[model samples]
Target: MKRIIVAITGASGAVYGIRALELLRKMDDVETHAIVTSSGQRTIAHETDYTPGEVRSLADHHHNPRDIGAAVSSGSFVTTGMLVAPCSVKTLSGIANSYNDELVVRAADVCLKERRRVVLMLRETPLHAGHIELMARATNNGAIIMPPVPAFYTLPRSLDDVVDQTVARALELLDVVMPGIQRWDGTSVVPDDG
Candidate 1:
């Protein structure tokens, strides 16, 4: 089974992370390892119907944010890569600077050093120069800084549709294909006036 690490932080878009886990669970060949920050737990409670325990149960394995010595904390534990869905700015800073202050950052750091993909679903807005620079830094370190931006062309029917679209894109970076994503076919771009 291929392994992936999914991390959730204190960002406002906790649903993004939760949706990512739920979708990943659908793939029988993929095993999800999750890390939920203390702040992330609080955010889950604040933002979604899912309890913190429910979120943890979505993954094949779960790690504590404070567990700096977890298996995922080391490069020896091979994985497809790490995805920090709804990544908090604090977590982004840690990954960009190689600071392993916690398991979430530590695992991402290890993945980077090992030349594996690290996708950051950064959930922030009103970016200042500092945020842009950090994103650049993380990009320079081989991390994909993907904001959870929705594609409006899809004409999403509900909040769940928007979430699924973003989550599918994130998983695509890790080579996981999810069904039901409304991909742009370019045919809708032009009206056939015939």
Candidate 2:
């Protein structure tokens, strides 16, 4: 089974993290290992109906963010990749600086050093130069800084569709196959001849 690490930081958009895990859990080929940060727990309560424990149930394995002894903390620990759903600005800064004080950042570092995909779903809005710089740094370090931006082209009917579209796109960055939201091509359904 392919082990995929999913980290949930204290980002405001808790639904993103929950939806990502819920979707991943349904996939038979992927084994999800979740690490929920302290902040993430608070966000779960404040933003979503599910509690931290409920969310953890979606994963095949769960690790505390503070657990440095976790198998995923080391680069030698093989994993398909790691994803930080709704990654907070604080976590993003820590990751950009390579400050491995916890599992979230540490696992990300491990993924980067091991040349594995690390998808960061950064959730801050109104980003200034500093936020932009951190994103740039993360990108330069082989981590994908994917902000949770919506796609209007999909014409989503509900909030779930919107989040799913972004989640699918983020999964695409991890090379995971998902039925992403259908996008409209500029041209017509059939080829046009002048």
**Which predicted model would earn the best lDDT?**
1
Model 2 per-residue lDDT tens digits across residues 1-194? 77889999998888887888888888888889899998999999999889999999999999988998899998787899988998999998988999999999999998999999999999988989999999999999999988888877766789998898888778767777675445456752221121
Off by over 4 Å in 1: 189-194
lDDT of 1 by residue, 155-186 (tens): 88899878988898898899887776666556
Relative to the unseen true structure, what is the C-alpha lDDT of residue 70 in candidate 1, on a scale of 0 to 100?
A: 95
lDDT of 2 at 131: 97
